[model samples]
Target: MSRTAIVAGQGALPGLVAEALDAPLVYALDGFAPAIPAQTFRLERLVPLLDAMADSDVSRVVFAGAVRRPRLEPEMFDPRTATLVPRFLGAMQSGDDGALRELISIFEEWGFEVAGVDAIRPDLVPGPGVLTGEPSAADRADAARAAEILAVTGPLDIGQGCVVAQGLCLALETLPGTEAMLDFAALHQGLRPDARGAKGVLYKAPKPAQDRRIDLPAIGPDTVAQAARAELAGIAWAAGGVLLLDRKATLAAAEDAGLFLWALE
Candidate 1:
């Protein structure tokens, strides 16, 4: 039988990818696949896994989900990882994209074909439009301003999304994420709560030159609910790069909550 390995990661993406690829799931840690049999392996065991695959009848391998950035403390470095430590550190110091490309190169060297989620779920990619109801003029103005600021700040790895109101930034998402940023904006006094309507505008986009293989910005129903709770006006995402998890359902929920969802080209 031709076997394929699904390398698991932290989020729903890994599970979804494994299903889509019809592969035997391999967990990075203690993950268990109830419906499909899977094996658990440590990150350092990757070299050996690749070696074993070479002897097997495996035809392909696919990576999915989010791998937590590996912690590089001394104690955590096994022999397999230690040899690559210097190169890995150098790449990280360079940039996120470089590091991801290097890792993908390592996998390819091991004879595994590295592929992106787009290969399996292209429909989930966002397209240009106001996905829900039309954004009011005020919402559009705020969204545009937020997108402009995001374009400037994102390349520096500051954050991927921002909340804006009446052409002023209400809150820019830091490490806390979009939901937390909106919550913070709702509590701040300077933002006009009643003028732009409930829910302020949220603009999300890729950092300029961001690696498409990893850390692509994502939005879903949870983001919409957070905006609703914060009374924000709308949500905007970059058209081609952002992942709209459960696109139709997310838009339906946003519409139900009277929130505008737009995808900017």
Candidate 2:
């Protein structure tokens, strides 16, 4: 009777993974999860959770959903967390890819095989195709331009998403995230509601040196809604490199909103 542990975070992805694996869900107390039986731990109280896993049949660990870095207080550090402070601080200072890899290393050091969410749901990675709406020639060019911008920004660990319109770079996502970038794009000079044709395209891809095991770019129903609200031509992402969460619902949203969802090569 093998058991797997899900380090849950925010959004529907964690719930999806839990359902897919029938795994024990664990999460930091600061985040949200479904109203189900799940073990909750504070950011610094990881040892107890690890010990509990060791005592159980759990052999693998998978992380799902998004987690913002928590601020740590020196007074709150337990003995185990105190010892891990250096590594934790290092990961915090590094790029997201490096941080996730460090986390994977930490879990592996505790004798559990770390699994990527893709292991449980391969179909989340859609192949190259236009999933909804129609992209005009200008839209296609914007997608290409956004991709080119991301190619240069990725290696710097800046961000995964960019928006382009009429051959102009509308916005680049930063620490504020993709949705905020879209909001900015929505109000940018080039994206007036009365503008002819489509406004722009949102292009997202993984960082050039990102570890495929975690922190892959993801788009869900909210993404489609935001793209639609941004009055964009479409949302474009690297096929097999982005997680299309709730594929049915996402496509439905895109179709209803008249927003194209393109899985680019």
TM-score to true structure, per model:
0.81, 0.93
Model 2 residue 81 lDDT score: 65
Candidate 2 lDDT, 160-253, residue by residue in tens = 9998888788899887888999899877745544477558889999998887778788999999898888888789999889999999999998
**Model 1: lDDT of residue 84:** 76
| Candidate number achieving the greatest TM-score relative to the actual structure | 2
**Whole-structure CA lDDT of model 2:** 0.82
CA shift at 107, candidate 1, in angstroms? 2.2
| Model 1 agreement with the true structure over 116-155: per-residue lDDT tens digits | 6666667768679877788888877788788889888877
Residue 54, model 1: lDDT of 64
lDDT of 1: 0.71
Q: For model 2, where is the 10-residue window of minimal lDDT?
A: 28-37
Each prediction's number of clashing residue pairs: 7, 0
Task: Looking at model 1, report the run of 10 residues with the lowest lDDT sum.
Answer: 27-36
